[model samples]
Target: MINLHWVILLPIILGTIVKLISIKTAKKIMVLFQSALLISATMIFIEVRKNGTVLENIGGWPDTIGITLRADLLASVMVLLTCFLFLAMIIFVHNKNYADHLFFFLFLSLESLIIGIFLSNDLFNIFVLIEAATLIITVLIMYKKANVAIYDGMMYLLINVVAMSFFLMGLGMLYKKIGVLDFYALETALSQVKDPQSLILPYAFMITAVSLKAALMPLFSWLPKAHGTPSAPSVVSAILSGLYVKTGIYVFLRLQIAFSPLIDTSELFVILGLITAIVGFILALAQKDIKLLLAYSTVSQIGVIMIGINLDNPMAYWGGLYHLMNHAIFKSTLFLTAGMIISEYQTRNLAEINGVFKHMPAVGVATILSILGIIGAPLFNGSISKYLIASGSSGTWIESGLILVNLGTIIVFIKYGQLLFGSSGKKETADSDILEKAVVLTLSMLCFLGGIFGSELIAILFNVKLTVDRLSYSIKILLFIGSIFLGILIYRGLFKKTNRLAFITSFELGFNEICLSITLFFAFMVAYLKLTL
Candidate 1:
């Protein structure tokens, strides 16, 4: 089979190569370009049909000098996601002006960088692509004329750029000890490091860098504002909230898998994941802007995936990867649906979106199904991984915390339900775009069917023992109960009274950012201390 590593990078490279000045034709040309990508991705997905990993070494150098490109189960799943979601986004903006060449450039640039991030075997190359992704996405967020959008994008840039700095520094420090810049090299070397200072410092830096990108706990403040501010294309939002965030998580997963023995940090990840899950949902309850609420909810879900990785059980490990793919599917659906509502109603204020289901049946169904997914409705994608999260651990205390997270997820989504179904005292009116309807319906069906048959999909994607009947049963019932009763309870009790605007000025939010910065600074200091003292 022909290696399509270059195919992944083609759109961006070609887009930059052919920078046509006519914005009128830019959208048309961009769609054609993306169509090509979709084709390439589809073929690649088919090419890697077996439930295993594939590696292509570009330039045919020795394995040490070669740039290795791998299409494992994980990479194939992402390719399908990016292709579908990105196409849906293109359809969403079909009628609009694609006059800005820069937006198109950034959009495709992001796509290329994403493929690179996943496929790159070298740590330094991954770090470079990560930064490139951050740069383009920051610009893409501010594609509109909104000041809030600029503020959001700027802060996102500021925070993640610092993260990239940390990432590169970690690479440099690791190279100083291990004399290698590739992930395969580092992973091979990681198990051999004996010095506490040499090992701990680089690993710590890598973790912080990835944690910031993944927006776990303290590093999550920028996501809501940045993702919420711009009227991003449905596809851009999908990539941002879905796959881009996973880059960081992927980094974490690779590091942990390769360096698990060198690190005794599972419980540390658990503690942080707990905070991320709880705090994100709490803040999600406080949001009146649909985008912001969903953004915070994404943060919460990240914590959930993080929890899965932290548990270290085989079921939990695969479950985390499962949740990561599931989140990409369903959460992107939620964001795309929200984007439709915003596009139709011309607002992000969920307070005004009451009864949105009444007029737009397609959108209503989409919203409800998305909410169900978030709530972890049975057979749907979210529940499977979430169930594993709660049950993956052995301790009563961990189980109890997982329950709280589950309950919290249920409650916050209830807030979403209310926001759509007249919680804020508005009626759903008729204004359905065919494009929006098609996109939402397709994604909703994907999630719904994905849920009922995800076991098969999981088996095909990864050789894990995830069967439909095996995962189906009592757990869904308990979660559903929470989704109904406790959800309403949290909605009316704590969520109903929460303020949305306060997030910008809230002490909790402010303190979170300040604390994150301090933690990062202290991390740097510790590196210096580890070396000198």
Candidate 2:
């Protein structure tokens, strides 16, 4: 039997060893290592799918005393996604001449930490890995060493360190109560507790930290700065927006399950998700920088995913997971393409750079497909996921709220699509190479096929059977079309007329304010759980 734990260890070991070699040699070895890692991750996914969960105890010690690593369906799927994304990122940056051995080393180290987070069954291990990943990401974000990048990296590092302190405090609380750190054991201990309410404080502390990591609502102030730092490389932005943010969501899911027996805060999360979705889009609409626009869009999509997961509906939960993967694909493509466009134009302003179709047809087409997926256009991946989520809605309020969110998303993208047309006579300097084009085209094709075979893909991925309702499908198409028209109208009638609203784009909270928001959010969650549970 293959020790699944080795899957996590191999990358870290190779990353460390690569530091001893020259840059060119390290790049070659890193590529080979990533390829092997992807294969190992795929094998793990297949084994888990065929034979159920895999578990390993470190040093062959007993579960009670030793650390445990486990790979269930969710963890396996996440591992596979992480590996594939890392491979794509490696290829995306391969030709950029930025292949410093240290860069590849840190990149691989970050990859290892991410996989560890997904597979580890111990709370302390998760905390350590998250903290390590945060440090590696800060370094990567400021790799170019520009002034703004340094500030962004510092802010990211500080905020996350504070957040992880809460996580550590919660770990201490859990140990004080349960005497076990393994997740399964913690779950058992939580279930045996005579008064589950006593676990509320630890839960509040831990979840508040996870919420900050996930960039929920007011706690999201750090995400835009980190993801859209002006000096950071585009691939850095892509990875942060695509893979890194999902870590927070993954942690949130795990923490919820670990605490499931003690409390149910799904309703509270659902409400907060709605608020985040609305606020995120509103902020996104006010952004002129293309990357910042996409970053805020990510915040909005994260909100939607949060709502779907917490809705107490299996279909909605599945939809949310699917959307999570879909968002990673499309959003990464957008950021990568945006980086290319920005490079060619030497500017980040969306309104200033027009005629993408004429300048970069392949990239423009890929961008359009991604935008369609994002807006939930018919026969696209977003539409299928949104439909599944909508199918599970029970109340008029839920449906109406979803419609409003969709409208907001559509409006934001409609504004984004402006860059696709209108000729600009200036020639672009940074040409797309074959590898870049291939990556974009491959991702764009997935966006289309993911929608075309949405049900099959869902079944294969999650092993959940779901049937599409013809009537509901037709209605959703109509709604999508209507939303597009409404979005365009709103863009013309309202957005173009608003100059005062740009103040929101410039409005930012400092570290102290963000900490206060975390505290306030924690208090609000504790009160809600006290009342509801």
Query: In model 1, what are the clashing residue pairs, if there are any?
Result: 355-422, 379-451
Q: What is the lDDT of candidate 1?
A: 0.73
| Candidates in order: C-alpha RMSD to true structure | 3.5, 1.5
Model 1 segments beyond 4 Å from truth?
A: 17-36, 46-52, 98-100, 422-429, 468-472, 497-505, 508-533
The clash count for each model shown is: 2, 0
Clashing pairs in 2: none
Query: lDDT by residue for model 1 over 408-503, one digit each (tens)?
Result: 888777767765664434354566777768877887787777677767767766656754334445855665775578667656775577654355
The Cα error of candidate 1 at residue 465, in Å, is 2.2
Give the range of the ten consecutive residues with the poorest summed lDDT in model 1.
419-428
Candidate 2 — which residues are off by over 4 angstroms? 427-430, 497-500
Q: Top lDDT: which candidate number?
A: 2
The models' CA-based lDDT, in order, is 0.73, 0.88
